[model samples]
Target: MAVKDAAKDEDDDNEVSAEPTPPLPTPATPPPSPTQEHIPSSPQAQTAQP
Candidate 1:
């Protein structure tokens, strides 16, 4: 019984280590995105006005 418990505990440890961690929340908007967003909107607005 003691050996069985130890084996189970070892398996639990291995599972804990092997389990993949959930992905962290990443910024959906990247840094260069702000400049890209602005660049396109400016031209679209200019065309709309003229």
Candidate 2:
């Protein structure tokens, strides 16, 4: 019925909101930190050798 469809749609919206949103920003934010750290570390080693 109409009520059942509305409930299902609400649940699907909640699940979609909960699942993808947290993980999208999580991987995105972490990758930049590691890459920046690695880049700085490489330059630090070169600086030390010189």
Residue-pair clashes per prediction, in order, are 0, 0
lDDT of 2 by residue, 1-50 (tens): 99999999999999999999999999899899889999999999999999
Error of 1 at 33 (Å): 25
- Candidate 1 overall lDDT versus native: 0.76
C-alpha positional error of residue 27 in candidate 1 after TM-score superposition, expressed in Å: 17
Using lDDT as the measure, which candidate wins? 2
TM-score of each: 0.37, 0.41
Instruction: Give, for candidate 2, the lowest lDDT window spanning 10 residues.
Output: 26-35
Inter-residue clash pairs, candidate 1: none
How far does residue 24 in candidate 2 sit from its true spot (Å)?
A: 6.1
> Each prediction's Cα lDDT score?
0.76, 0.95
**Pairs in steric clash, model 2:** none
lDDT of 1 at 35: 70
